[model samples]
Target: MPLDELPPPKVELSDDDWRARLTPEEFAVLRRAGTERPGVGEYTNTHTEGVYTCRACGAELFRSTEKFDSHCGWPSFFDPSHSDAVILRPDDSLGMRRVEVLCASCHSHLGHVFSGEGYPTPTDQRYCINSISLRLVPAED
Candidate 1:
């Protein structure tokens, strides 16, 4: 769905609640803004039809229809299932500048987004995301 067509995120969580719900690795990446090792994420090579939801809050984030193979060592999405599902912020960490993507409902870091890198997609942008930050809900046939 388009940004204007998607519904708003309705779930919210406290820091302590999130920590309690997520595992150490999940908390590290989602809450602490840590990055997982490249090519090791669970969904890095998954091409199934489904919706990817926030691991921390189960809020819908990305859809399989928007995913593409960028061979970038992680899950890549050309566009979010809903524009309002992800929040982009300027990241100046690691001595570099990048746009960071996060779950709008729980404010968990999904990953970074890079644009104009020559990917042939509708948005010309790559949402480089971590599998740890997302939970796949496969579409019912």
Candidate 2:
């Protein structure tokens, strides 16, 4: 469904439900706000055309067209599939400040977003997402 037409966040899962729905690695990043090691994410080097959806709720979050080679060791997108597909919040964890991006549907932690790094993308922003937190559905030919 289009983000604008989608209802508000309704995919609330309990800790046990999330653990049962996702693998341990996914649970770590998506449920616990943990960061996957840089350069090791499955989507870090992916160049295929697709819509990347939240692994937790299957909500469309980003598109390959907005993805760029930020070389940040994770899938990086300059924009989302829709402006409301994800929610951004102030994160001051780990002794620093950053923006935390979460799936709007399930409130699952996808990753962080950074801006003003001098990227050539139009938005000059990077949605640094974890591979295990997303599932890419390739676009039709």
Candidate 3:
């Protein structure tokens, strides 16, 4: 699809504003569309019960119940908090074809989703997300 055919950005901020709002690492990953090193994400081993929200826009992205270990070196969720909570776009960068997941509200690069790996998830798909793009809200007892 052409650039004109694409939807408008969810949230627009000046480069300086984005830089000020996010850390250097976050600005690189979310604004510049970079990826963190595998197995190095903060949420990779987090087993806490909570909802994960967008670090940039505080948009709820995933629920703890949907999380699972895919051993793919990232935070894996079987589903988003809601269908519209995240946006999936075709990413052919780096000479590879994959779906890029972004925060619907702030358009931050969360990560990628992969399928057909035969995970025990209900959707059988892994929503591999970046820890820097998410902030956990622990569930209250």
Which ten contiguous residues of candidate 2 have the minimum total lDDT?
1-10
Could you estimate the TM-score for every candidate? 0.91, 0.92, 0.93
Candidate 2, position 45, lDDT: 96
* lDDT (tens digit, per residue) of candidate 2 on 11-41: 9878999999999999999988999999998
Report the backbone clash tally of model 2: 0
Candidate 2's C-alpha runs over 4 A off are 1-8
lDDT scores of the candidates, listed in order? 0.89, 0.90, 0.88
Candidate number with the higher TM-score (2 or 3): 3
TM-score of 1: 0.91
lDDT of 1 by residue, 1-141 (tens): 222343454656677887789999999999889999999999999999999999998989999999999999999999999878888878888899899998888778899999999999999999999999999999999
Q: Residue-wise lDDT of candidate 3 within 19-107, one digit each (tens)?
A: 99999999998888888898998899999999999988888999999999888888999999999998888889889989999887877
TM-score of 3: 0.93
Query: For model 2, how big is the CA root-mean-square deviation?
Result: 4.5
